[model samples]
Target: MIKNFHQYYVYILSNKPNGTLYIGITNDIQRRILEHKQGLIDGFTKKYGLDVLVYLEMYHNVNDAISREKQLKKWKRLWKIELIEKENPKWSDLSIEWND
Candidate 1:
């Protein structure tokens, strides 16, 4: 349960538990997560049904978040799985859906 407000985050969204990962960086984590959840943005994410918030890392600076996002993107799938498992063992979606 994340309660802190932060500026930037390196987040991973998935189509399902441990399925089809999409890595991204965002300043407004909640809003961006919501957007993906609702399929509001049309692209690879929307196409792949990448809505589950499997992993996230908050950062105070955009540069750090972007760098982390890039590094994660370059990593092999196994490495990404290890990184996610280190924090989110069950691979659960963290987004608290605010939609009515």
Candidate 2:
């Protein structure tokens, strides 16, 4: 049986490829990304215009997602770039197709 199957997301936003990155964890990735795009959310993302969803990962637990978010936050820029490219080579805005 799948116990505590709640899912969470750890996502990365960027201004552009190889640009400023923001790592965050959210239970609703699509909504959160939309908020970032509309500048509804304050702080680093809004201030830096980090609206592009370049990378994302899902976890079964909030703690796992939060842990990954914190780990990615401390990663060197190059490492983060590599990680993003691994999934999104073009660094495309994954949220674009979300219709927000």
Model 2: clashing residue pairs?
Answer: none
Residue 24 C-alpha lDDT in model 1: 91
TM-score list, all predictions: 0.86, 0.91
| Decoy 2 TM-score against native | 0.91
Per-candidate Cα RMSD to the true structure, in Å, reads 4.9, 1.7
- Report the C-alpha lDDT of model 1 over 1-100, residue by residue, as the tens digit: 9867658989998887668889998888888998988889999999999988989899987788888999999999999988888888988778854453
lDDT of 2 at 45: 95
Tens-digit lDDT string for candidate 2 (1-100): 8566587999999998888999988998888888999999989999999999999899987888888888888989899999999999999999888764
Task: Give the TM-score comparing model 1 with the true structure, all chains together.
Answer: 0.86
True lDDT of residue 19, candidate 1: 87
Colliding pairs, model 1: none
